[model samples]
Target chain A: MTDRTPDDLYDALRDRLADYGQEPPAPLWAKIRAQLPPPVAAPQLRRRRRRPIVLLGLLLTVLSAAGWQLWLVSRSGPAVMPAPQTVALGSNAPTNAAVASPASAGPSASPKLGKAALENPGMSGASISETKSSPSTATTDNLRLATQVRPDSAASRRSGPYRPQPAGSVAGPFAGGSQARNPRLAVLSRSARVRYSAGQPSLAVGSTDSSVELPTAAAFSTSGSEQGRLPVDVVVAPSAGGHKAVERSTAPVFGPVAASATDYAPGAPASLLASRPVAVLSPALPQPRVQLRTDTFSTAPAVVRRWTVQVLAGPTLTHQHLGAEPASDPSLPTGIITYLDSIVNEFSRRERMSTGYSAQVQVRRVLTGRWSLSTGLGYQEYASQTTYVASTSTSTPPILSSGVFDMAPPSPHRSTYRFLTVPIRFGYALGQSGGRLRYGLLAGIDAALYLGGNSAGKEAVPTAWSISGSPYRPLSASVSLGLDFRYRLASHLEVLAQPTATYFLNSLPRPLSGLTPHHLFGAGALLGLSYEFR
Target chain B: MPPPIAPVDEALLAACRRGESAAQYQLYQRLAYRLLGVCLRYCPNRAEAEDALQNTFVKIFTRLDQYRGQGPFEAWARRIAVTTALHAVEQHRLRHPTPGTDPDDLAADLPSAEPSALESLAAEDLLALLNTLPPGYRTVLNLYAVEGYSHQEIAELLGIAEGTSKSQLARARRLLESRLATQHYQQLP
Candidate 1:
């Protein structure tokens, strides 16, 4: 056979050099030994030991905070104000007059007047009696009522704006025994344990309220002395037993009212005043002209209006599917085509889904009851491991020289993709707002910026390496749905667990040889804490 | 023909697996010369080959648990040496300007040595001839001929087209044959 044949020449060359060997420098082993990694079990053991302690610590902290918040809510009293007592209407009484029953004019007035009387308005006489035994009164209580005084009284005759004084000093002619026989008029004096002061055409009466204090509801101001005053009128209700009334017109109870013949009527049948069991009436004054303004404050439950901040982190499982066909470059040799097909097959075979992690901090705004909107910055990492196996057996169209050659063993290569994400989500809460346990649903879109990533294995195969630049759109987006579970640890703090599923809207394509792109899907349950501001 | 390979000592491998420093050192001493020879075939210089040898041994020790005693340990170790050497060559080519474009420029990067006289030479030093070739041609030749890789395997290993690997190997063989003929003719007297 001619030795000029390529195979013959190569075989001769391989046979001669097959037993080749050479000594390396003495320092080589020490260099390799220096790069050795520490044992793997230690770090894993430490991580395992740390988990339960952290969970227990978190539980203890939540319990302590919940107890503290409950204590605080109880000590702070009710967060809402009570309703005002409704003034019973009398037939002959002026519409603008604010009159009280003589039975309540005593110093033993019930602090539970507003609630009990309003609850049983038809049997208010019995309700007031039942409520009078209640000692649960507001620590700081004061009720103010505005009334008009008659111009003929010395209190109203003063020029300019009349300076107010103690209720006793301005009692006028109704100060002494006249106050006792007609307790309705006495309700405005010092004997009733009330503070009353009068200005031109206006009186300010302050009394201890056993229940609610409505200062703004009972205040009035007159601009000048030109504003005329109407005579103060008293309408007393009959007792529960139909007790005879002490006639106010029997004496000069009110100077202006007693002097007017038309206004004063002694022994007038109380029946003409009202059809109810008890009625207190005031003679209708011409142009009594009192501007009565009842400023009502809302009693609705207070809403949590603070901005909530949530920090979340979790382990994420990512699934990636890459689809590609070999490059159809027919101009290349048949061997190259075969090689490209092998590469695609190898890549598909080696790729595997793996777990990664994601973390984020979010600020949420409660737009209305049970509805919220949140946006935050987050980071997500996805990893895929590809294993490349080496072969030792000789292939067809074998080596020019017949000999065994070394090949690298099978190795696992991990390719990671990192993204800086911005998520905007809307949430709807389920169940009561202040309850300790609550559930919610969330839906949103997350936009991501492709942060650079690195591969953890052999770089020999370009298709197995981390992908970037072309084919990988620098920007990507995904739609996610989540079930959010929240446990309120305190008034302002809560623990949150959200199980989420996200599907990427865009694809990250493999470089070279790979034509079709791959989409990523992720599922994770994130645990976090949310704190609301006071 | 297959190269000569020593048998693996199971007891020594077990000790190395247990992270014994003495056993690791003994394993390194036993295998260093052969793996270094394997490294020299692909790397451009002895120093780079030595560096490749160091990396090869590091990989072998760290991944020793993965070795399942299928073939002789030497064959497995030699394979690691070849991969490490190829990685070094690839890194060197990337750092420099495109040396593959001009074969003469690529050959100039290697050290020049005199050919041994015929008859006096016990065996033809195929390695010296390989050193005279350019990096691309020499790598293709080493993988396809000496390493027994198919054109498709060579393409995947070197990240090149199979046609390119085939053509490069042909050129490398022609150069080697002509040089060998010249050496024989000069030593004919």
Candidate 2:
């Protein structure tokens, strides 16, 4: 009997086999209890979720917002990163040659270190503080670092007359790579000790007093190749002891990059990029070598202790439970639930996705290198849809039939929610310290106060099916996660794009169920620009 | 032929149709275990089958207005229960169906054996055998052999071509018989 084939067993036992396992439908009952609304009190579980609209219109509007002053900066390239805080200048103000010649940054030596190189004969102190490749350094220590005459003593001791080097000039042992090179290094004879009797600050092109003047190209003689014409300017200024500021330069004064715009106009000598490494001719020391500090002016503002502000606006997505106002008849099975569900599902289709826009203006404080805390006030609007079904009879009759055709309900309709949000986020900026394009990440929690929102349900006509107005709650809490991409158009102006997601902890709409909360959350791709307030 | 509706059940059904909580509960208790067994053979596990059972009862009560004293209420209820299980299977959303390489050819290649050993099989063994078939194969076999639905009816019911139903039933039978033969040979040794 035990060895019989499947045919014999089934032929004998077909339909006779009772409940094989005594397993009651316990979990099934639980799901029904959880999902189905009670006969008297319907479950308010929200099945609707938010979907983000492609919203190309919004994106184009933000991008072309000519009148909206995001104060856009243009950075299709990388900014030069600020160097390390290896050298401190103390109280002695040092002139920055890097402002004049970006590629000429020498070893990061303090003013004292540079001066020591100037006084000592046999000393070859090439203290080149390696330039940081990252353009996003917001540290205080790096801000405290100051520029010096030249990078190190190697330039002071190297035995070569000052001559203009081409842009590709090898950055000897002081540094490497094809950086902007000043050919006229004016390499001092090893024995020279350059110092100012009146503490005349070392002169560089950009650091020159506004009163400093340059000579016409005809007045100056070019000593290098046509591309790199070195203008022979012998400048003499009244030392600090004399309050009067005067320029005696027949020579061309130029901040290589800035000079092109200001000092060296269209007809001005184009040789600044190729000009001699301009040293401060103390009018006493024959050779005073100056190295440019390429770190942007904003790089070392760590001492400025400034708090910044930015604005973020993007399309966010989330879901909320909508409309628990039932139109069910107690006559149907499960009464109101069955009737209401049928009317909503079979007649008027309800939308499950919530689409919204989030715009926040945030105030950020740099807590440390690349780390900042930002808190912002923002406004968000979320929209969802439902249809209304009404009876054809005169008075507002309860749902009377299981027949979907009983009332011809209007097509789908929409519901909107607006919230005033206060969000606090912790952010980390990644990329070059002073680079044009910056990338970062931020995470935060928010307490979103629901500003009074309007609920427009489809207007009900007697005998017609229409959707009821979805109710709203006053407040909701949520968490946000996002990635930020930024472009620095100017020293103080930056355009930013942050794509983010916000998850809510409580439901936005009061659905029929008391225990179940229809929490809504959203995602937004925020694109806005920030201006440094300080 | 299906059995007639009992008078006591008829009274209970009427009460349930009217959404009487106690009567609905009574109806669920009496038929739930039996319906659950039918749901179980088609589902991957007990929990899913229970879900199918719950949906079946909900459907039964909601569509009670249309149930017109046709055949027997249990038979109609069991039909709903069976189809609900198939619907649950469809909801699983199986992906990447291969290009059908002629179901007829596949059915032809499979080894066949008389499932005579079914006489010795307990309900658990039968369920075990049923579970071994793929979802489509199990569904087709359950409808055709157990539920007595023809291939054409099964095709219309499942939204498949009639040929697909016949082939799936054949493959299901082949797989079950092979397994039965192996079990029978093992027991004999």
Candidate 3:
């Protein structure tokens, strides 16, 4: 019988098959691609050679500049001297001049004046008058002594003829004849025999030395005594049992006498005693004003302090499906699927030593729930051990032989590894749920900075050695999916668990002697603590 | 006459490759009713036919890469569809025991109808007749008359002897002939 083709049957079946056509789901492609093995590339020797040259140039330039700047700064010692102090005292002397000269001669050489007297000509009853005398010849010893004793009183103002008396005199208006017999003010005037009705003063300085009877509630009284040349004692008695006394002294005054009396309560009137005999003073009298001026200048400048710290450590498991490939070997006929699993145990040990604690300040803007946008600089050190395996087996040895090369099998190889990755992530927080127990999803890109690693100790004899082609290269681009969980401990502190799945897009440098390049699929789960402030 | 190639049909093919949901729905709308007719020739009932059609599409997309550029895309797709339908039939057989009926008696009751008359019949009428056949008979008949597989090829595919395949085809034809003859008589009365 002649061979008859089944053309018609095939055509009929073809006609019927047109009835069913549809597409698969979207996740199918993603899952399938994830299962395939990554492509291998030999590390380019030219690029490798150029990278070190560029890095060396950069290092040299930075070192040179830093060294020069450090040298220059060291050569120039402390930049500025301490400033002088500003002492607020009772004298009318200018701050700079009073700080330069001893206080005894300085304040009294100048005309007695109040704040309004300096600002207006006739307001405070004092005027400026210049004298053409030599600095050494201008003697104001008595006036300076009077100024140091009681600078705020009307009695001190009367010690200088150029000074103006207060509008109300000590014994002028409130001293009535019959009200000057009060027993309370009688102690103020020894020679004046006087009596007050109930609230009046017993003696008045302006009255005659005759016995006077007045109300006991007499509100005004005055008494005076002479020491050497001018009136040394001037006392005013108030019906409230309070009195003011002025005393004159002649000595080189270093500071205000009011400051010398530590028991001079504020807003209280007390008896004032002045040394009367004028005498030459020592040149080395301690100037409390000058000491105060220097103290104010010695203080340090105001500054803000901030401290940020993070620590991370945890165990993690990650599974990455490379992709499906056509069966290259008869032993695995269906196809080869690359699956990567990593069991990582890591510890992030950190210790921060600081003294003299300061407040932590944060200038972060809240972007979403429990998440904030922050622009800051930080330093982190990360290290991890990664175990890697390739799905394909080759009988040929690798072209370059590093220490790791002798360990790979002729069929396929598996190794436990270690490396450091410093990843800086910039992305948005997709969402977060639960308050104390929070979970958030983030998609971002990370830069994996490789340190180095040691290959697994277990070695398999090479069955197939290849010298022409390189195995898969290490991945470089880090497209990551991050899941974060945080438990807030305090207002500014939290403990967090962050699991990240990173897919590297670029290949890594091949270790010279291994079957596979350093390419890897890495995932990490980190349990860390963070401190924040507002 | 050749059917007009609508722009939407091309668009649907492109989108289906990209796994678009809208294109998949459009493809289902255009092909579901027709595929149900094809599925019924191998299925014992309407429910089983619809199930087979659903399974056929799922397999077609999954194995789309197996369809090399050697032949028409439609023809390749049809082979998958038919194979999927036959697999459904085999699965059904494992679940249910065969009925005790004489093949000759069942064949004697088959309907006799002209090819033109069968062609003019509505899809629904053809589907109804196909659903009435037993699972074994319906599967063989669809593979022979509708799908156009030779008895040898059918035997190889179904894992049965060539003689069994020929006998099954003859029995299926006689039953359809008697069913058609009865319909003609009913019309005459």
Candidate 4:
């Protein structure tokens, strides 16, 4: 072993120092005892503070998405039509004529079918009771008249624009109690109503309805004053007892009906009709033809209109600034603009408000005339914040009822809720329903249920952490109030925007007892599109 | 004189934990010198080692609840003393810029009093040889050989890499070997 190995040398050296121990200098333990600290819950020297980052992230995403949607909602298309709808025909100055018996005249497919009856020219003015003939001869001659006249030739006579007679100017169809005497001719007038047609005219019944459907519905709304039944001259079927004299307007429903067979003029652009509500008339019944002088295009036929079903979807948003209330106009004007500015500034802070979002589908049912009832289902999300303050002062202060945020501690307690909502709204129409610009007022309440949420107490800082009880209510129900403004983009499409405010009925408590109770008031807007199933 | 009384370390520890001042003193006196050696091997000088020794005793008394009593009390006390000594060295470095701590600097500035007097000396006397080495090399050697620590564990404690710990230990061993080869096992000066 002339050459010692490295490991052997290292072991020999380590063996020498293994049991080493020596005396420390004097007064050592005394120096150490002086530096001791008070006992702590845990020996961890550092604690971490995390901001409400998830809340802020959710808020940012909602705001960005809502802003983009709002931009899209603001976009609109031009659907203007130049064809004069509801254009009156003929030289006859419109008279305030009461409507004639629409049931008294049956539309004769053969022009010659009525020619034999009209052989006596004065019969146009004669009443049914005045016409007396042997019943067997009257029935046989009417049947022969129906067979002998050519239906194809009658189409040639429909070669002119229709003239609208003043419905009030014409004699009432129910005049002389004729309908009472003949059970088949009875028709009733109820609430004020208006009817809309694409190229066809829709008639809203009487005062029972406040909203009127105008002919040439969407882009060309007839003035509300123009709403009423077609000026008298519609055809009605006489009693099967014996053929009677009938009052008929010479105006053809459409000159183009026979030429195009599709009824409306073929040359007219379909896009113009798209902007207005299209009235689908049963092909069996033609419009009550009006006799008018030289006009280029045909007008809508007057017939009782049907109820319209409107569906709309769109994006909407609303925000009530943090620490804000619904603004009320001042009873008296104040001269100080700066004071007004200061008040606005106080309510305009963003930090005080919590924003939420929702997606909704609505179906509006137009009722009698001007009033409609609306209801829809929506998924809504909203958030609110409350704060708890640590009181350093020994003496207690009175708790505030309005909001406890002012005197509370530095820590903020936040609560969030997701809700499914059902809203019942009532609307009153201000103008004709088919017009380019229609105005209305909507008042509604949304019944909602809480889906899920975070409680403020769970996030309270250590200084404010004093939870002996739960700070949240069960997730059952909540309610909101809103006002929606509607605008129509097309016959089937409308845009609705509602500024809404939500109130959580239950009061939430902060982590620390005796802190101000937490109440959440969230305000935002909901936007949606409406589609009508006419 | 009569044979030295046996150390009733367990009973002394139990009494010391009950706040008996006399028992605490007895326990401290019994173990202080041994722990002082551990601190001194890590510390750059005796004053710092003495301060570390004092801190270790204070912590042991204040945190006696931490002891599970699975191992001997001396080993537990020895660990605390070593850690305290290492902490003192780190604190010194942070407060004052460190001077050169390589073996070359040790040889050039601190002249050896008796360099060849280690191999034949008793194991208890080997502390003088450790003190002659650079601080980094001496700490690595002390932790690895005496405390039975792995290079990775020594690296973590000293805040260096495992390779650096191994190299430091090797250098300290080489310096000791060279010194040992130059002398015979002679009695202390």
lDDT of 2 at A234: 18
Which candidate gets the maximum TM-score versus the true structure? 1
Itemize residue pairs with steric clashes in candidate 1: A111-A210, A235-A280, A235-A281, A406-B79, A407-B79
Interface Cα RMSD in Å, per prediction: 11.9, 14.2, 16.4, 22.7
Q: lDDT score, residue A438, model 2?
A: 84
lDDT of 3: 0.35
Rank order (by lDDT, best first): 1, 2, 4, 3
- Report, in order, each candidate's fnat: 0.30, 0.16, 0.03, 0.31
Best by lDDT: 1
Per-residue CA lDDT of candidate 1, range A63-99, in tens? 4465445433433332321111112111111111122
Report per-prediction Cα RMSD to one decimal.
Answer: 18.0, 24.6, 25.4, 24.2
lDDT of each: 0.49, 0.46, 0.35, 0.41
Worst lDDT 10-window in candidate 1 chain A: A125-134
Please count the clashing residue pairs in each candidate, in the order shown.
5, 64, 66, 65
lDDT of 2: 0.46
Model 1, span B1-189: residue lDDT tens: 223355878899877765678888888878887778777888888988888788778667755754557687877787777767876776565566462366544333333223232223444256776687787788887766666667877765655666888788877766665666665666668
Q: Score residue A137 of candidate 4 by CA lDDT.
A: 26
Task: Please state the error at residue A328 of candidate 3 in Å.
Answer: 21
